[model samples]
Target chain A: MVEVATILLMGVFAALAIHSNVLRLAIIYLAVFSLLAAFLYLLYAAPELAIAEAVIGSGLVTLLYLAALKRNRVYTIGVVNEQQRDHLSDSYISHVERSKALREIRQFFLLREFEVQIVFVSSALDEALNDPAYDLIVAEDGEGFAAFTDDESYAMLELEMMVQMHGSGSAIRFVRHSEEGVV
Target chain B: MSDTNVGSESTILRLIVGLLYPFMLLFGFYVILNGHYTPGGGFQGGSVLASLFVARYVVYPVEDTDTEVLHAIQRVFLSLILIAPTVLLFTGLVARFPHYRGLYLTTMDVLIGVQVGFGLGVAVLRFAFFQGVGKTWRL
Candidate 1:
């Protein structure tokens, strides 16, 4: 019974690992598969190999995969210009500055080999800020601009540096939202 | 997989991780030190020890773990793992005293454990650093 159960679990986890589209979930499934393989090894009385399998195969490999996945992920930034209306004729100077800022931001991320996706949102700035779908949000605030990001965003430091260096005289402020409070 | 996904912020998770960390470390060391009579050995224990760092990374992804120190430790232990056996062989200790085999095995196991632990820790730290988890993302 135990042998049959271990084999079943091994097969299930192996299938899950192969079929899962999410890399994290696939790595987790692979961990489960390794754990089941360890159990199978233990059943065969190869306790030494079983322990090795349990530790290296399940633990170390899973972490390695997660790290690789994180490094290769695409970064998405949402740009919500509250001043942008369909019929409004924007001033040339401000428009040029805005475009320059956007280009600088894109170039900064591109240099780091990250795929930068600038998503233009027509919704309200507050709505965009609260939306969990976006990793970052750059919105107009009065005469200046505010970049809103959560504490978890990895590229925040680089983004901040880029904005400070090439924001083109715009009063750009970084607003970070933590899990507990806004900072 | 998303970069914006922060570490677990729940009090329950924090409490559980805090409670379990010490035990994990203890068991990992146990596996390393008692490998002769036990099922686990250096590699297993090393991986277990590395898992402790991985768990800490999961709980507090922003914590700064010194990868340079870990790398140095791994290199030192790896050298010891290589040098110790060669010294033992050249000194005719193993040949003269077969009774010291168990001691030699245990010493090697401990050295391997430390080496593997720090090696894997360095890997994890490099991953965290490159992924821009903490302030080490300068590049």
Candidate 2:
């Protein structure tokens, strides 16, 4: 019976991991795998692990998937209802500084033909830079700087605030463009 | 009949759900209550019930779901779940000092079972419904 269950479990796990597009499904599968593992442990006379899996695997995983779903949904819905969407840059960064870097990043997105978005998480303003469907998350309480970056760009930014937020020794990915950003 | 339509799977699915969901809930309750006497307990049963909720979600849309009431019940039970063990511990100590018919074991078992079940259920649904891991959404 255990062998059969394990085989079936493996099959499901494989199916779930193969689906990468929908992150929610992947997470659900992981939770399920953990849960099944717990049950197996219980059968094998290990109640401690069973309890842990029941609590952490199923409980916590479910909570995470739901929150992400709601956040994205709410933002998308807002964009649909509001026809015109404006950029919500940080007040400190809102005013176009006419910096060589910022201009270049903007131009690169246009040139490469990759639809891009840059959001500065701030409490004062909430606007979507390019896609109104997604917002510039102005977080009152959050850890680290939740922003995208390139390898070269990350090296340039001091990332002091982010370091303080996320603790030292963490890395950020900065995207780079080979071609010059042009309108 | 001109415009009315129901999928072939609809009737069968409803029948299956109707027959199984209530039984599942009842069985889960039995597990929690008889936890001391059996291998299974509240946490196991509560999870089963939560899975039933997932089934319900599959059968119906979230707007159509009893999400509000479900969450309300979860909140109430979660508080009870947290309080159960503390209550058991204190009450057990009191009984132990008297050295009389101490019922701490029984009470603690039952209370813990219920608490654990409710906790597990809430946790599972919290994650399954997309609230994000460890990030709680208040009912």
* lDDT tens readout by residue for model 1, A1-183: 999999988888888888875668988999989989998999999988988898788877887788777666667677777767344344833563466456666677667766766667778777777777677787765755577766566677767876677646745578887655567
Candidate 1, residue A108: Cα displacement in angstroms equals: 14
Give the DockQ of candidate 2: 0.06
i-RMS for every candidate (Å) is: 5.3, 11.7
Residues A1-183, candidate 2: write the lDDT tens digits. 885787688677867757654557776777777778778778889774575567456755555565455444321111111211244445535432243334443443343333334443322222332333342222121232233322344322433243345554433223232224211
| Cα lDDT tens digits for candidate 1, B1-139 | 2344575577787888899999989999999999999888998899889988888876777646778888988889888988998899778888899999999989999999999988988887676657444333344
Model 2, residue A15: C-alpha shift (Å): 9.8
lDDT (CA) for every model shown?
0.77, 0.49
Model 1 sits at an interface RMSD, in angstroms, of: 5.3
The CA lDDT at A167 in model 2 is: 55
Q: Candidate 2 versus the native: TM-score?
A: 0.43
Best by TM-score: 1
